[model samples]
Target: MLRFFFVLAVVVPWTVGQPVDLEREIREAFNLGGFPSLAVAVVVGDDSPVMEVHGWADRAAGQRATRATQYRIGGLSKVFTATLLVQLRDEGRLGLDDPVSKFLPEGVKLPADPRGARYITLRHLATHSSGLPRNPVSRTERESDPWNGYSVQRLYEGLARTKLAFPTGASGRYSNLGVGLLGHALGRSLDMPFEDALRRKLLAPLGMSSTRIAMSPAQLKSVATPYARQDPSKIVRAWDYGCLAGCGGITSNLPDLRRFVSLNLRAGLSGVEPVRGASLTELHTPQRIWDGWSKATGLVWIVDHTRDAGDIVWHSGGSQGFASWLGFSPRWKIGVIVLTNCGRPVDDVGNRLLRQALKKYRKLSPKFRAMAERLVPHLVATPGDKVKGLFHEDFLKDVPFSVLKNVLSGLAKKHGACSRVLRVDPADRPELANVVFQFADLSLVTGKMGVSEGDPAKIVYLRFGR
Candidate 1:
């Protein structure tokens, strides 16, 4: 007996075979996920974003978030590091198949890596299974800024004390130490600093005005304060990893990322080439298995998969005070970039926003829908389903069909008067179709039960389904 309300139209482009307003969907999802400050961009092409959405980029100052704001591109630094290695390969200074010993100073030996020290190639470092310890230098440095001064001498020093557990090329383990070596290899091969090589090879030619291998003093002044969590009320400063910079020292804002995505969509790692196609496919191609997630290494890029998200070529990085998620679909030519200064979990927020954008902003294939449907079995339901359970036995079962219908109708009117009903429709159960309620920040709910479970019918739930 829930009052009937308008159903949501598919918001994507008309050519995609459905109607949806992806921007509104993205805004709604961000709010639901309780992100205090969020910036979302949908790149239709390399040079421009077809859709952009922002909310409370700075809640304390009452600043509205915009697509122009920047965020720290965490582990994404691996992309630049790996890109530099590929560029070096193209220059014929070395081969992708070259061993670490070839580029190292005489007498310096990398430890027996998970890949045999002699058997493990530079490609393994680019792929992240060199199997160096999780982090080897943080203990001697300031805890708040652990990687600032680690060096080849220090790395060699650590290797002297370090040991490997897994066989090379047989499995993969994520190691910042491994990717850092890729950067080290580049610096040695090119006879310049790691950061400088990136400027000449990747960022400079791409015309990414806002992207950088490191943050300049001038950029810090204008940087948006990142939230400790999605709630904007908590603002905090970020960390600087000096030696780890090769793996995650780069910082970028939305505009620069949008520019970077544009280049990626066009070049697919060819950069600007006399090279006909890619020898760089391994970055996005799967390399190992991790439980439900498969790991792939293309240069330094980490690739994983999901049911509905096709070959999600993406990555997210987190430093002490900030977190970031950047990803795109090569098939759809659509990418989403989310920036948050908070250091904790933000992937759920990022994923929800990305799904919403895909729903309306582009022409998705049937496979996308099939993938999403498959995802349903994987979701653990929130407590909200209780309302239907309670209503089925108590509120819905006894009332005379008409009177029960009227009561639900009246309740719907009451809730409607108090809050806006963005859309309404029949849900899974046919018994009580007139459920009406308002949305709130999911982060705020913690473990609260829906009133429909037993408290009452005031709690809100939305219809998302097959």
Candidate 2:
């Protein structure tokens, strides 16, 4: 079993000078958004996660929102479903390239193009490249009941009548139907319900007992009362996903979701079944690029790669009357979870809070300025040959100078040459520094540089972008 030895309940201490009014900020958001209730948890590095709850769990019942309050995570359940699929793949139960038809019910036929059903694979489904629509339900049916009146038999019937958006694996598109199908098929493969299979393979091992599709009596009482976004006084009914629960039916609280983020931060390196780092890495790696690389999709995780930092992996979900967002940056080892009873777009709130925490916690180091001072000249003067000499030999192994040159050249072409080093600030890592530079066109760029521990401490990591 995975141990919870690191699950500290203590609050993270803030630096002496930089006092972040996290609770105050969250309260303001809750009040301004007119949400019924809001629960937020932030996990930074090895320190304990900090949680803040505001407003009412159920205004009519006179109950307050608390850390223990549960909310339906909606499509965030896809993250869990995807994780379960990865676990099964790692256990050698199935292959990612296996065709969808292999696991589907006998009568269910997923729509395909001229190439046919054989081209659709679990890999394509997980990556949302299976050419499936967002949902099998029609617009009129969805308007009447978004989650209800949908069943496995209906899903199969819908597939029989539906059409593919494009050739399988030809492009990227978001598809709840595709991921939901993957989860359903995996359950059939294991001869178990998707909920039970996910609990055994992922949730139970991680001690996420509170996250589930079916709420216990106690959980039902603790769950925040769902409400319409435009009218908080109007209560909304929770969804019952039935056979399609694999897509977006799980309800989870802040703590359990925090643990989920922590697991991803560790890259799933240690656990009972011990999800191989390679498998988790595959989940985080970009499987398809979209909108000219502005956005990318990993298995089921949405990935945003920052040139100077690392990848920010995230997912957001919305049920009839609940909205939730979970996001983390692997490079910074920081994550945020936002849950609310009101059905509204709270992603901006989560994103802002995460950016604030990242800015506050990731202080720049003194060593960074020195490295940037030395490298800036070459970085600005020559986008090509000479810059390679400044990088450590070992650093070249992880990233070739050619790749670095291309990145720097691309930035320069867009923003113009570096005119001056504006400031050098502390970074989260001791060996790394954050440098702000003013370009010839007056545009600003934040550059990150890290050095080795040798006598010379040659530059090992270099990245520059907005």
Write one digit per residue (lDDT tens) for candidate 1, span 186-284.
Answer: 787888877777777777776666776566688764566766654446676565555556777777777777777655555455443422136444445
For lDDT, the strongest prediction is: 2
* Residue 429 of model 2, lDDT score: 49
Residue pairs with backbone overlap in model 2: 363-426, 363-427, 364-425, 364-426, 364-427, 365-426, 365-427
- Number of the top candidate by TM-score? 2
Candidate 2 lDDT score at position 115: 65
Candidate 1 ranges with C-alpha deviation above 4 Å? 1-18, 34-36, 50-65, 113-119, 137-143, 149-152, 226-235, 267-282, 289-295, 305-309, 361-466
Error of 2 at 340 (Å): 0.2
TM-score against native, each model? 0.66, 0.78
lDDT value for candidate 1?
0.57
lDDT values for all models: 0.57, 0.77
- Number of residue pairs clashing in candidate 1, backbone atoms closer than 3 angstroms, sequence gap of 3 or more or interchain: 22
